[model samples]
Target: MNFAFTEEQQMFRDMFADFVAKEVEPLAEHISEHEEIPKALLKKAAMQGFLGALLPEEYGGAALDMVSYILLLEEVAKSDMSTAMVLHVHNDLVSRAILLCGSAEQKEQWLPAMAEGSVIGAWAFAEPDPAGLTNLQVMARAADDGYVLHGTKTWVSNAGIAGLMVVFAQAPEGPTALLVPADAAGLKLGQRDKTLGMRGVQIHPVYFNDVAVPADAVLGRPGDAQAVMAAVGDFSRLAMAAIALGGAEHALSLGVDFAKERKQFGVEIARKGAIQAYIADSAVEVETLRSQVYRCASLADQGLLDGLSASIAKLWANRVSYQVANRMIQTHGGYGYILDYAIGRVFRDCRTVEGIEGSNRTQQAAIARSVLAAHGFVM
Candidate 1:
């Protein structure tokens, strides 16, 4: 029940904070404005073990625990949710996917480059169809050598720059996940999508037009959707929590700073009752989410957390983050709404985290399912 971070974890947090202060914060606007992550920063982040925090030391990765990874994600997201989104995709969705479900052979083949940042990865879990099917819609038919993939995935984060992608598909064996290289023949990327937020992070609809890959490309046992999803859901939810918490904390900090500096009636806004209440609420909310995040992350590190816990953490944190960010913007008065200030970006960025890793609505359904199962309901 001790939620205090270990001294080592605190030190790691401080180190990452320094890195973010110097490298990431300066480039947040640049990335958000251009929808691009600088190549050099990517290299530096890899060197800092962000890209492959879960990979074992044998593969040139830091092999960080779930708690430490959460800390890193939180610090980075505070500066730029877009860059944070990219890191989460590469680390949690891609690298972590392989480590959790990847075959030993597959790990050997790809984990090194992934850990070194020489290769970036994406995980495509959604379909492009208008019907909104959550299941893998891409079809992979067995060919003479391996398989031919035919389908498209929309709003795939990290697709634009990913050197490799873990694509889920309907294979002959059933729902399967394949490790498809970016340059595979017949693979086509749709135009970069103009997203409302996270515009700096490239996303698109990826088309697998008879894209082919060898049998070894399979990440794990094909058709074991339950196994793959069980692993994916937990970390995805935790990662989203980290992203949201970071934004919330940063927005709250921004509001506090602005309050102290802005004055009305010859008194600092910090002394005003209304502005102080906003800060008070935001401060409390940030701590509340922080407690949930660390508690769940600790449980995950101990292997005591279930998918239900992850979903609940994400559901609550995402909602709270938006609330906190919105309040901070309100506290800033007219200045917050302007693009020149960072709070406006934080407002939009938090909204995007709410939708990803399955939307807040999706998490509600998942949490309900868990409740039913706990209550002895069976299908």
Candidate 2:
């Protein structure tokens, strides 16, 4: 398959890189320490259409193809994983769902504001049970006028700041997807989660206490949560894999620069065989991951992306990122443990993506299932 980026894609990558280098990289340390992305930086990103990278042009979006969209996320990740995740949740999980499943009226009502970034989107799916859709604790009871939602959604990304949320809950008919405004009465956001990394993501537990939404608030059809979630999950895994790839590349660069400057004995550490091997191994893995990420994006564009491919890419990316980050830390020696070093942050951020869309165990199970099915082994 052709992996070469088109001229347009290259141009988009350059634009994204320029923006991240100027506005994101400089603030990466500040964001991690403050546990917040500056509102001004987010607004500037919105103005550049990065927030609307996947929506159609009619809705004021860039309408980027999947590869170009991947490029955007990858570039942002090289600077700040937190900002990349914000864009990922907005475009991949929330806006894309609205564009794909919402009725024309729903689209008209939400898409433009979402594209313009006046309305940011968040996903509310994970619950305490962690069994996924089949065992969602959140319930949407049908009422004469509409539905009243009751339950708590945990680990909601972009929680407090999101203008809109796509929540999944159990209905009488089974699992269902609904659109709820963040300001709806009885919808409360808990204190922000103090995560191990990716501090700027703004995750929180969302409480829905007798929250009411119109009958039309259902996304797509009732009892269609499984299908909607599966689609969104596949794309999110791929997007996350791209993020891991970018983070790995950035870590490698930092390690290489340090090794070249760090003096050992009478010469630089770059002259050492061990340092050379670390750099070479990391470079190889980074290139391999780049291929996997772009191939999956191309598959998505061709409507040929499958659960197996996405799972593999995500699992591999997570593994490679963590490994590369660890090796780079070793290369940095004591400096790697210091907060002043960028590798420390990169290492922390790499750990967080492993559990974002689907945990490493989740991906492993998915890969096993696919393999067994292919081998004609029925569970």
Candidate 3:
């Protein structure tokens, strides 16, 4: 039941915070306005060893533990949410998947370049008709030379920038994941698809029109896409919550500051009982969410994570992060609604959190199944 961060972990957190303060925070507005993350900033993060946060040291990575990775992501999100998300997709999703399931040859070929920021990574799981693999619109058919993947992937993060991608499609075997080079023939990177928020993040649609790849491109086992994707989902669920909590904490800070600074009726709004209550409630909620996320992350580090724990954390984040953002806006009144303030960006972004990864409704089903299984009940 030990709960304190180690000295090394604290140092890592402070280093990440300092990096964000100097590099990411200043560019938050610029990124939002321009809708792009400067390549230089990503290279700076690579130099800081963040791009390789999950890989083993042998792969030229920092080999950070789950807790440290979570901490780094939260701090990044605190300064810039889109930057945190791109890191999550690259480090937590793509790289972690390769580390966990990729062949030694695959690891040797990709990890070093990814760590060096010479290559960027993206995950293409969602589709125009995303039914997981059970009802995949994209299908991969085996040829004598290899496999040809045909279908469109929607809402793919880092699509335009990534030199490599991990793609999932239905195969002669069940669902299958394959490594597709960004420049592969028949692989078309569509224009950036705009969304509700996270403007700096480049999410796009990709049409895989008979893209062929060698047999060695298959990830994990040929028919093991379900399990591979499930594993990634657990990591993604926890990571999404950490990102959301960062937004919530930032929102609380904005609210408390505005409450203290904005005067009303000859006194500070901080003097108002309502303002005091919002601040108090937000602080408590944020701290509790933080603890839950860390606890889940700890379980993951210890190999104890399951869908249930991850879902609980995501549900907490999805429900409460939005509430906290709304409170921040209410505290700001007309100013919060204005897009000029960074808090407004947090508010817009937090709303979309409910729908990304797995939605709240989907998570509920997972949590329910796990809970029932804990008892003698079977579905």
Candidate 4:
């Protein structure tokens, strides 16, 4: 089967690459050092149609296909993973959830603004529970006319900056999601989290204390939160895998360039057997990840729900990213560990993929369950 991108897709990828090189790469060092997300950069991305890549055209989005979205994600990730993450959270998790589950009016109200970047969306799901099973905990209770939300969401990206949030909470009926206004009363945005990687995307804790939202705030039916979350989870895992693949590809490219230029014992490092082996191994890993990501994306685009494939791609891609980045760092020796070098930041960023969007261990269990079910195994 032909795996090459279409002409239009190629053009889209090139355009995104140019945008990242011109707008994001220059600010990467400053963002990493200060842990600041450049709001203007996000606005620029919105204006350029990057924020709405997957939304329908009626909602002001380009409504590009999933492969095109993946291409754009990869290009953005290659420059600044943090900035790429901001777009990913907005597009894949928040906006996609609304599109997939919200009522028609809800879509009309939120999708256009979200696509225009006037309303940024954040996903609030992760918590500090050691078990990491916050989905089963009821944090908000539905009242007669509205819901009283009470809970704390940790590691929430764009918590303070986003205009809207899709908060997963437990309701009296069951697990549910509420679309909360960022400026809602009784809602608090905690101080920025100091993470080792993806610093340009602000991570914060969100506290909802007696925050009231109308009945219409519910996304889909009550007790359908798990379904909505599962869909989001699948898309997010695959998208994150694509991002990791992009980072690994970037790391490989840099390693190759550096090896070709750096000389040792009066010969270029690229010519050495060890360096050559490292490059070869990294290339293999990156290519494999690319294939897995594309296959997952294709399946999603076709409306084929393959949780197993999504988990496999996410698990493998995350591990491959860490391996590729670590090897690249080793190849660069002392220089790779320094802040001045981009590999150091990429290395840290790569580590985050395995943990976020569900950990590799979680993916493994999910995959195992899928295998058992296919084989008619009953627990």
Candidate 3, lDDT over the whole model: 0.88
Shift of residue 358 alpha carbon in model 4, Å: 1.6
lDDT of 2: 0.91
Highest lDDT among the candidates is held by which one?
2
Candidate 4 weakest ten by summed lDDT: 129-138
Model 3, range 155-255, lDDT digits (tens) per residue? 98888789999998888887888889899999998889887777888999999999998889888999788767776788789999999988888888878
Report the alpha-carbon TM-score of model 3 versus the true structure. 0.98
RMSD of 1: 1.6
Candidate 2 vs candidate 4: the lDDT winner is 2
* Model 4, span 207-227: residue lDDT tens: 888899888999988767877
For every model shown, what is its TM-score relative to the native structure? 0.96, 0.98, 0.98, 0.96
Q: Each prediction's Cα RMSD? A: 1.6, 1.0, 1.1, 1.5
Could you tell me the lDDT of residue 244 within candidate 1? 93
Off by over 4 Å in 2: none
Error of 1 at 228 (Å): 1.6
lDDT of each: 0.86, 0.91, 0.88, 0.85
lDDT of 2 by residue, 230-297 (tens): 76778889999999988999899999999999997879999999999999999999999999899999
Error of 2 at 175 (Å): 0.6
